[model samples]
Target: MKRVINFWSLLGFISVSAFLATEIAVVAAAVVWGISSLFGLAMVPTIALGILVGVPSLYGMVKATILAFQAETDPENN
Candidate 1:
């Protein structure tokens, strides 16, 4: 049988998923920054370190979205 995916549902799912991904990433970055600060790292370096974590998380989110888009949607689920 030919599988089908809903364009509108996929769009909405990715939009929400991306937003949540970034939201979690930001929190993770903040925790990293806080921990570094507590360990005596200077302000500027901590922020930079946070970006290191954040950028990869954003990359992961993009990859996940692409992969999810490729998934086969079950007709029964529709």
Candidate 2:
């Protein structure tokens, strides 16, 4: 019922967040290393690399979250 659905949703959210975090971390690390090798400054390169890798994921997450909120709020859903 409701409790079961809520549990599954919570689990799904946790798993998805963990997966995304891991993906972002790996991509950010790789990008930072690559950029640092090319440019020789670890800090700025890492920040830039993180931003480059993280932005698209962030955008997609925001879009999906907004869509989910919209669906939840839709009168037809009620």
Candidate 3:
């Protein structure tokens, strides 16, 4: 039982980390694209597109992290 719990916890941690990393990457890419556009890179429209897509992705990641932490700490479900 202990081993199973540990495995699940580890899996959860990995899942959250992967999601967060992806979100951070998206945000970083968007910022870079936006900055590049300022230098007349013709990517302003693409940067806008990135912002439109990245915001929701980031929000979902934050929500997932909160939910995962709650699941890990809450005793009611266990």
Candidate 4:
């Protein structure tokens, strides 16, 4: 049978993804900034580095969140 994803479920998944992605990006940015700061790097470079790190982290977090949601909502396993 073809699986049909409900609208509400998709919306909830998106909301959850946003929350997780935000947290992941924040943590990643903090870590990158902290490391750069420890090395006595300039504030501007540190902030730039944090942004670079945060973007990839957000992508990874979103992908992971999608996988988790898919696992939970897998109709076959129900």
Candidate 5:
């Protein structure tokens, strides 16, 4: 039998994943900024570093979440 993935399930999964990614990025940015401030690091470099770290993780999470819902080509292969 072929595996099936419904639209709503995929949508809900992606939406929740995006929300989680956003929350993580925001928290990471705040923590990095705070730590940089404590150490007297410059604002521009701190923000840049935060974006460098957060954006890739966010992209990776979203990609992984979407891939998780993909239907298998051969259900029995699993």
Candidate 6:
């Protein structure tokens, strides 16, 4: 027996996964900013902190998701 991965399927899966992750991050950042506002944190510092934390976290998550998807789709896995 043999297995095959469809290129388009992988691409679409990765793209959609990344997109959903970005959307979640955006919402989370907004919530963090809003909470900081309630605590009277300076807007500039809050925005900077959000960018510093959010970017790398999002990147890591997306990278991990892609790797996992690839592993699952690998024909040799079977």
Clashes of 5: 0
Model 1 regions lying over 4 Å from their true place:
1-8, 19-23, 72-78
Overall local distance difference test of candidate 6: 0.72
TM-score, one value per model: 0.58, 0.49, 0.50, 0.65, 0.56, 0.54
Question: After superposition, which runs of candidate 2 have C-alpha atoms over 4 Å from their true positions?
Answer: 1-5, 42-78
Clashing pairs in 2: none
Highest-scoring model, lDDT: 4
Residue 28 miss distance in model 2 (angstroms): 1.5
lDDT values for all models: 0.71, 0.62, 0.67, 0.76, 0.67, 0.72
lDDT of 2 by residue, 1-78 (tens): 122235445555556656656675677668767777788877776787777777876776666555554544444544
Model 1: per-residue Cα lDDT over 34-72, one tens digit each: 789689888787888788877887787777666555552
Better of 2 and 3 by lDDT: 3
- The C-alpha stretches of model 3 lying farther than 4 A from their native spots are 1-42
Kindly report which residue stretches of model 4 are placed more than 4 angstroms away from their true locations once superposed. Answer: 43-48, 55-59, 76-78
Ranking, TM-score, top scorer first: 4, 1, 5, 6, 3, 2
Report model 2's TM-score to 2 decimal places.
Answer: 0.49
User: Alpha carbon lDDT of residue 17, candidate 6?
Assistant: 74
> In candidate 1, how many Å is residue 39 off?
1.1
**Cα lDDT, model 2, residue 43:** 77
- Candidate 6 lDDT over 1-78, as tens digits, reads 343567765776677677767776877678777878888878787887788777877786778677657665767763
User: Please, what are the lDDT tens digits per residue for candidate 5 over residues 1-78?
Assistant: 655545655565667676766776777778787888888878788878777777877777777565555522224424
Alpha-carbon deviation at 21 in model 3, angstroms:
5.3
Put down candidate 3 lDDT per residue, 1-78, tens digits, no spaces: 222346677577668767776877777677767666676555676677677767767777777677776665455645
